[model samples]
Target: MTAAEVDAYLAGLPQDQRDALEDLRKRLKSRLPDHIECLSYAMPGFRQPGPKGKMVVGYAAFARHLGLYPHSGSVIPLIDCAPFKTSKSGVLFTPAHPLPDALLDAILRLRQDEIAAGYGRRG
Candidate 1:
């Protein structure tokens, strides 16, 4: 999604989902200036390195769940994702069942490490 799409997407969500994602967005932005609001893989995302930046993490709302994509399939294993459903690329949650704070921290830290190791470095 583009910036406008992101706004529209969020705006179109139900109140609870919107509130949950907005809070997630804040937490995503809390770490670095590079984690700016944008789109990644056509979803609501944060571009690290700021404008025209590499995608660090992104999220999207689905009919049944929400997603947190760290842009690295490998980073998924660094955290314990026992209770939630996880794919090779991301973790899935619901508004009634968002990821815990510790899991979010672990995901962010692991993503940073992966980036520093040149996982998602843009040309």
Candidate 2:
């Protein structure tokens, strides 16, 4: 997938969701300067650097909320995502209430660690 595809995904979203996710995309870019952007499972995400890089995180816009997916079920349980709806692998938020920087950072760090530890990647 290409950055244009990711932009298309954002462009197709509702304005509120677009704005929220655009902010998220920027923040994620700033935090993950070395990570490559890509699309996975129809969502915009970043991948680790390698011939076969692993997806580190993903974000999507839903009818009711936005989501930050760490691409790992275990990562969600390891963080404190109070005030946001969360499932086994995704953290749900809204444009009105987006994921805080600290939370996003924590999620990325944990997922990066998991990738470094040889987890959540294709063998």
Candidate 3:
């Protein structure tokens, strides 16, 4: 889905879920004003174009929780995601208690570095 489609997707969600996800999207856009917003793995995310163009990260909201997808193999595992269910695949952030800014910053920075260094390529 394109960025517009992504917006539509969020709009279709419940009020609370839409607000939470849209907040995340706005913050991400402010941090990555130059990057392109795209649907990576069917989720809303940012990407840098070129030969090395790749999705740095993405997010999805489910019936139970919100998920951050770093698109890497090791970054998620390296972080301590206490009180939240986490694994190599992604980190779950519930609406009742969303992820902290520090953890989200760390995740984005790590994924950006991996993309810049050509370390992790999404499948």
- Which candidate has the highest TM-score of all? 2
Clash tally, candidates in order = 2, 0, 0
Q: How are the candidates ranked when ordered by lDDT, highest leading? A: 2, 3, 1
Where model 1 places Cα greater than 4 Å from the true spot, the runs are: 1-4, 50-52, 121-123
In candidate 2, what are the lDDT values of residues 7-117, reduced to their tens digit? 999999999999999999999999988889999999999998777889999999988989999999999999999988899999999999999989998999999899889
Which residue pairs collide in model 2, if any? none
Between candidates 1 and 3, the lDDT winner? 3
Cα lDDT tens digits, model 3, 46-73, are 8876555777788998988899888887
lDDT of 1 by residue, 1-123 (tens): 456778887999888889889888877777655456777676888777645556778888888889999888899977789899999989999998888889988888888887778875569
Residue pairs clashing in model 1 are 1-42, 1-43
Please list the Cα RMSD from the true structure of every candidate, rounded to 1 decimal place. 2.2, 1.2, 2.3
lDDT of 1: 0.82
